[model samples]
Target: FQISYAGATDSSVQFIFYQPIIHGWRETDFFPCSASCGGGYQLTSAECFDLRSNQVVADQYCQYYPENIKPKPKLQECNLDPCPASDGYKHIMPYDLYHPLPRWESTPWTACSSSCGGGIQSRSISCVEEDIQGHISPVEEWKCMYIPKMPVFQPCNIFDCPKWLAQEWSPCTMTCGQGFTYRVVLCIDHRGMHTGGCSPKIKPHIKEECIVSTPCYKTKEKLPKEAKLPWYKQAQEPEEGTAVSEEPSFILEGWSTCSVTCGVGRQVRLVKCQVVLSFSQSVADLPIDECEGPKPVSQRVCYSGPCSGEATEYTPEKAELLYGSLQEFDEQYDWEYEDFTECSESCGGG
Candidate 1:
C-alpha cells in the first residue's frame, strides 16, 4: 500500500509505501455431534478473519498471502458409548411386516498394507438390523443374504507413493581443502504418477558445504575488465540489442534441506536474477547484478523433529549398508557426510 503527497514548498510530489502485514487462519467452534449415542462425528472449519475490521472475509484474502495457510477443518468424535439394551432377556422373535428390512453394511477401511507397489485395505463386512427405536445392531450374515454385499477388501496405490532418492555426492569442490560438493535428487513413482505430492520439509540437501580434509595454501584473485584502451588494442563494438529485458526480477528455487537432520536448523533457498521482457512478457535468466529492488527472503528456520535418543550418530558406513555404496574416492582419508538418522515431528511444518 502506498500514498502520494504534494510538497508544501514546491509542486513536486513523493510517494510512501507501507510495509506488508501478516495474516492468519481462524477456525470456527465445532458444531454439535450427529448422534447422542454410539459413535458420532463433529466438525469445525477455518475462516479468514480480519482483526481490524472485526469481520469474516473471503478465502482469497488468506490464501493469497504465502504465510497465511488455511488450516484443515477439525473433526471430533462424540457420543461414543453404546446404547443400553431394551430388555434383559434374549429371544428370537418372528419376523413381522412392521420391521425394517435388514441390510449389508461395512466398517471403515483400514490403512493400506503397503505405501506403494499395489496394496490392499480391508473393512469388516456385516449384516445390520435396525430396531423400531432407530438403533442398528449387527445380525447374522444370512439375514441379508438376498442383498448384494460390498467387497471386504479393496486395492490401493497401484504404486503411487514416491520416494526421495539422492545421487552419490561429487568430489569436494576444492582439490586440497574443504569447499562444496553436490548431487542430484528426485521424486519418482511407478507406471503412472502425479506431480507435486512430495513433502518439502524432509527433502535432502543437494549440496553439502564442508568436506575433504586435504590442506593447501592458495589465493585466488580477479583482474579489472575495464580501462582506457587504444583503438588497436580494443575489440570491435559489441552487437546491439543483446540485452533482452527492460525490467529484472529474482527467480527463487526450492528451499535446501535444514542444516541439521534433527531438532532445529536453518534452511535456505537459491535466488537468481531473472529478466522479464516488457513486450512479450517472456522470462529469462540474468546476472545477479541486473536484478532490482530489495531481494526476497531466501532463508528461514526449519524443524525436522527431535533427534533420536540413541547415543551414537548415524554414519555414512551405515547408510552404505542400507542404500548400497557408491564409487570410492582416491583421497587416502576423509570424513564422510553423516546420514539422516531418525526424527518424529509432533506437528506439521516448522
Candidate 2:
C-alpha cells in the first residue's frame, strides 16, 4: 500500500517515520518487520511517493477551495501617429480651421475648408471670410471718383442797331443799348454739365432794359442801314410871301407877316417901334422930339375939297392955332395947302 502526505514538512516527515507502523517489514532482521514492511521505509522513498501522489489529491481538494485571486491590471499604450511638424492640425492645435487665410498667393501655407462636412483646400493667406452668413473674402472695395464742371458767360450779339449810329457807338454799347443788358455762361470742374451763375465779372446788370427788333437771318440782313431823321425834329416854313417875321404880334402872335396900305387922310405907320409898343397906345403917346411933324388935329371937311380962299399971313401964333384946333373946315375958307401927302404916301408904300 502507498501513502500520500500533502502538508508534510521535514519535522512532520520525521514524526510520521518515528511513529509505530503496523503490518510493516524492515530491511534488517533486527525486528519482527522486514524492509518491505512500513517499519523499514526510507525518507527519500517517502518524498518520492508524496510528490506524485499529492498532485492527484490537490486536484480533488480544489472543489472545496474559494477563488479569491484578483484579476491582472491592463497595460494601455498610445497607438496613434504624431501630428505633422510643418502645419498645425485643426483638432490638435490651437489654430481655428473655420476661418479663411488672409492671402493665398502671398502665404500658401494657410488653407480652409468649404464647410462643416466639406473637404479642406489651399488658398491665399490674406483672404478672409466675410462676417455675414453667405458672404466670403473681401472686407472693402473701391469706386470711381466724380468731378464737376466750371461756369462760363456768353455775351449776346449787338449788330442790329442802325448802321450810322452803330459806327458812332462801341459794339458792346450797341448790343446792350440803353435798356438791355448782357450775361455770361457758367461751368463746373469735373462735371459734364454746366450749372449755377456766372462770376461777378461776367454777371449782367439787374436794371438793364431790352429793345425789340427783328432778328437778322443772313450776312446781308446784318448790314447797317442809312441814318434817318429822328421823329422829334423841328419843322420850318418857306422864305417867300412877305418874309414872315418870327417876331409876334397881338392879332397874329406867332404869325410871320403883316400887310399895310394908306389913302388920303389915312396912312400906314412904318416905325422902328418896339415890338411891345404895337399893342400899347399909351406907350405910343409918350414924348418923342425926334418925330417933328405937323401936330395931328381932329377936323371935319365937307364936299371933298381942300379949303380954298385967300392965304393968310403965316405967324407962330396962327400956326399953333391951326395945328391945335379941333374944328370943322368949310371949302370957302381961305387956307394955305401944305403938301403933307408925301409923308402919308411914303409911309404906305411898304
Candidate 3:
C-alpha cells in the first residue's frame, strides 16, 4: 500500500528528478510568489511520494536577485519624515526603519549650505527630493571675502648689498682721492641717537688744494739811465773833395737814317740821333719831370746805304701804296717789324 503527498505523483516525481528544468514553472510550488522569495527558485524532494508523483519541493531555497532593494514604509511608532509622493506634499512618519527621523513640516525646504554630516534631522523636503533625484542647487552669487597678501622682504648679503643703508642709527664714511670734492648727508650715528638728530645736511671736503701761480721777477740787478735820441737822425756831411759841379749840357752828335716797317708789310724811313749828356746833381736828385717832353720830328728811310728807292712816310695819304706793297711783299716773303719807342711831348724840350 502507498500514501500520496499534496503535490506529488509517482510519474511527476520521476520526471522532476530526471528532467533538467531551465524555466517556465509558474504554477510550481517553488516558483517565486512574493518579493521575499526573490525572483525564481529551484526544485527538490524531501518527504513521501507515490510512483505517479509529479510534484517536488525545495526546502532549502536559492534565489537570483538584483541588489537595489525598494524602500519600505516606515513604522507608525518611531518618528520620522515620510517619503515624498509626486503630488507635492510632505508627510511625516512615526518611525523609520529602526530609529526616529525628522519630521517634514514645509515644502521647498533648503538643505544645509554645506554637507549634511550624518544622521537625520529636520531638513527641506524639496531639497531632500532634489537630492534623491540626484540634483544640486547652485551656490548663491555673493562678493568674495578678500584677503590681502603680505609683503615679502628678502635678506641681503655682502655680495648683494642694498643700494641705500639699511639702518638709521649708523654713520657711514666714504673715501675720496686728492683734488676731489663730495657732498654727503649723515643721518645716523652709532651713539644711539636714532631720532633726535636725523636731519640731512650738505658736507663738502676737498682732499687737496688746487693752487696756480705765475713766476716772480728777480730783484738783484741795477742799471744807469742813458740820454734820449731822436727817432730820425740827421744826414752826415759829404766826404772830403767831393765837390759840387755846375749844370752840364747835352749836345746832339749825329743823325743816322733807319728804315722802319709799319702796318702789315710796308716799310717807312726815319732818322735817329746820338747825343752826349751830363748832369750837375746825382741822378737820384734830378727833377722827376725832366724825362717828360715832346718827341723830335723825323723822316723814315728805307735803305741803309745811299737811298735809291723812294721813301714813303707812314701817313694816311700813302695808304693805297702801302696796301699794294704789303700784298706784293707778303706773296714773296714773311716779315715782321715792331716799334721800340713811343712818346707824347708835353714839355718844351723834345
Candidate 4:
C-alpha cells in the first residue's frame, strides 16, 4: 500500500499469504453413521485445512507429504448399538423398535363383488412413519420413495355370466299321422339355480312339428276275405312309427258328392290313389313303380238322408265346382288304371 496525504507520491507496500500449519490433504475424520445402531458404514474424505485462514483449502496446495497415499479411505463399518427384533433383526431380543424413515404399508383386499360374473374390489394403502413403541403416523407419498412402491388398485373377479340350459326332448305326440313333440328348457345361473335372466331371443325351441310316418289304420270290411293286403294294411296290431322317408308313398283323396241333386241321377269319381311327397306333404301323380298300393273305391252311393219331396234344386254355397276339378284330373291322367294297385282283386290289377 502507498501511504500519502492528498497529492503525495504513493508509498510502496508488499504482502504475502502463508499457512501456519502446512499439513497436506488427508483423511483425518469420518462422517456420521447412516444408522445410530445396527450394522452401517461411515464415509471418510480427503481434504486439506489452512490454519492461517481458518478454512478448508484446495488439495492442489498440499504437496509436502509425498509418503501419504493418493487414494484415501472411503468407508468403514459402524456399530453404535445392538438392534431389536422389531428392527428386522429377529436374533436379538424384541423391543419397541422404531424406524426413522417412512415406508409403504397396505391393508388386505376386500371381497369380490360376485363369485362368477365380473366384479371389482380394492384395498387401502398409506405411507407411514413409526414413533417409539411402534406407534405409526401418516406421511407424504414422497417420503416412501426409498422403499418399493405398492399398487393401490387391481382386478378382482373376471369371468362369464349365467347361460341358458335345456333338458332331453320328449317323445312325439302321435304314433301315427302328423303331430307334434316337446321338451323342457330352462335358464340356469352360475350357482346351479333357475332364473329368468337368460335372453328371450336366444331361447331354445320346446315345441316342434314331428311326423309319425306310419299311416292311421281304417277297416275295409268290403274287401274280400281272400284279397291280398300290403304288409302295412294286414296288421291290426300297432306298429312303431318311423321318421319321414325320402321315398314317396300312395295316399287317398276323399270321395266327391252325387252328380245330380235329385232322383236316379248318376255320380262319377276319380282314382283316390295319389302320391304324397316326403318332408313337404304336397299331393301329386307319380309313376306306379314309385308308390304301389291297394287303391280305394273312387265312386260310392250318396245318401245324404232319403231324397225329399219336390227335390228342389238347392245350390249350397260351399258346393265344390266339379267342372274345374275334373278338368284338372283329366290333365293329369286318362281316369283308368290297369297296373299299380298292390291288391290282386282290383279289376285290371289296379
Model 1: lDDT of residue 299? 48
lDDT by residue for model 4 (145-205), tens:
5446888677766756667777666555456665545555667776677665677778777
- Per-residue CA lDDT of model 1 for 1-350, tens digit only, reads 65667777767666777656444588778768644655544667678877677688787777767777766656556665554566342332332332356678888999999877799999998889776567999976645654568998899977656766666875554454545455555664564332345576887877576545767553432222342221123222222233533334456676688788885555666566655533234554554544444443454445566688845554434434422211122123222434442223312311
Q: Which run of 10 residues does model 1 get worst, by summed lDDT?
A: 322-331
Sort by TM-score, top down from the best: 4, 1, 2, 3
Of the two candidates 2 and 4, the one with more favorable TM-score, higher being better, is 4
Off by over 4 Å in 3: 1-253, 258-289, 297-316, 319-350
Residues 1-350 of candidate 2 have per-residue lDDT tens digits of 33555564553322233422112211211212112211111111001112323322323233232442212222111212334555453223221232222222223433333222234444332323332133555421110001111122222322221111101111221122222222222232223333332244543232233443533233653243442221122122111222212121111113222122211121122222111122121121112221222222213111212334524433445434442332333223323433121112212221
Candidate 3 lDDT score at position 180: 15
lDDT of 2 at 296: 22
The number of the candidate with the highest lDDT is 1
- Candidate 2's C-alpha runs over 4 A off are 1-97, 103-183, 188-192, 197-350
Q: TM-score for every candidate vs. truth?
A: 0.26, 0.13, 0.11, 0.32
Model 1 sits at a Cα RMSD from the real structure of 32.8
C-alpha-based local distance difference test score of model 3: 0.26
Query: In candidate 1, how many Å is residue 46 off?
Result: 55
lDDT of 3 by residue, 183-226 (tens): 22223333322222332233222122222233323343312123
Candidate 4 local lDDT, residue 100? 48
TM-score: model 4 vs. ground truth: 0.32
